[model samples]
Target: MDRDAVRLTVMKHDEPWAGAATTTGRNGSVPHQVGAPGALAESLFLVPTRHLVALRDVLRSGEDPEGVAVELGAAAATEGIGWSELLRDVEDVCRSVSGSLPPYEVVRAMSIAWTETAIHDAYETSCEDPLTGLASAAHLRSRLDDAYRLAERSGVSASETAAFVVVEIAAGSGPDVGLLRSLSMLVLADAMRTCFDGDETIARVGEHRAVALVRRSDAIRGYRALRDLLERAVDLPPLRVWVEGLPATSDAATRLLGELGRGASATELG
Candidate 1:
């Protein structure tokens, strides 16, 4: 099939696949294991959009497919999908392009890429992500604690006054997808900074994830502006934005935060 046809075929399934991916199980996302019959594409659709684009490119150009494979690996890591599952997706995608699939070596490339990025993220050893200059996860937690305390003193429910603005930005697809994600985060940080225009503790909680702690009163206006600005953004996949109310207690809020960064959908959070 031609490139346009390939992309269209993949995109045709987006609506139903999105519904399935967002459906939750014991965890907050698509299950790590193979699910029910005909579930391969359901899981594949949850992988980053760029990964699918790269795979399409691999079949079209037949150049440095390993690079595409490794990117798929990184995307899987970010999406919390497993290696075996990704391989299955690759095989499934093969059936799309005249039974031509990238060899198993592509899967090996993915494993290596995932491991290297994981190790780098593991030993980050900073209060801010060096890549995006957003507050560290630890710092975000501390800020949450402080917010809860201030709410306690103000005699209003924290849920009434404060909420989280979570934005899931889909970056442009490319061979250097890691860089694409980082670059998009930079754009997102600027947009959040401009829209919130306050002491919002904006954080890059996970790959493709960002959150800002903002006053609920301001959130309605801020979210409107944020969506406008991001919608005008060039070269990005669709952005997902929502203002989640603070959970009942600080501990519960923290637990929710743990899931937020890992690409949990709004349905799961609710």
Candidate 2:
């Protein structure tokens, strides 16, 4: 196809693909190469083998080109479908992308990525009580390591810094243990999000606790800001939280999280 014809005729099922074509084709030139797809794959942050098959399926077909093309374009349209139908193809595409690679390796990488994202998102959504996410204790362990690395890499280590803000929420006797648990998670999530930055991390390590890893040069101000934010975060039901501060030592994150978890249990009984 000529440059104008290619621009007009090539249908893009993914926004990232369209963006790649447009961005790479600027200055009146068509990319004229498969490299565009590779670049698009990189831009979307997709691991090539993980997404290549799925992306190709979305844009190509076998003998029944006309029929498949029509279906593809229809799926790309924004309307005229049941909710399930709308998502069904997209889900298939994602699965195909993830599935085509060597199953064990792809699954392993995706599992790690998925858990990391889940831990971060869960901490963001239900921070008041980290345990509400019911994440495996191992997830918090991983996040601690992640936080430690982030702090160490901050590039401004000359200044002293508070490494983490840990919160332990203990359930009281009569508050529906479940509701209090739920409330605690909400609060924990809030507290974590409140304290997090691009370089921060949050995770849950106990049945009723959460913690955040922060890198603030001014420890007192960071702690105060976090404390005040949690104090005003009202979504969570009544509960007692013990907050602690720790320096961003080379390996204090796990110990801090462990302390918060144990403290929550002790505080609950006391």
Best by lDDT: 1
| Model 1 error, position 139 (Å) | 1.0
Error of 2 at 74 (Å): 48
Quick one: best TM-score, which candidate? Answer: 1
- Candidate 1 Cα errors over 4 Å, as ranges: 1-125, 171-174
TM-score of 1: 0.54
In candidate 1, position 242 carries an lDDT of 73
lDDT of 1 by residue, 1-270 (tens): 011111000001102244333445423344322443433344434565447556756766767778888888887676666667666677765555446565777767988987776656553445787777788777888889999888889886666678887788664567988877878889998888888777988887878988888887777677777878887888776678777778757888788788887777676666
**Which stretches in model 2 have alpha-carbon errors above 4 Å?**
1-137, 146-162, 195-197, 235-253, 264-270
lDDT of 1 at 3: 13
Model 1, C-alpha of 43: deviation from truth (Å): 50
Per-residue accuracy of model 2 over 210-258 as CA lDDT, tens digit each: 5554454433454566566766776554433333444345354455456
State each candidate's clash count.
Answer: 0, 13
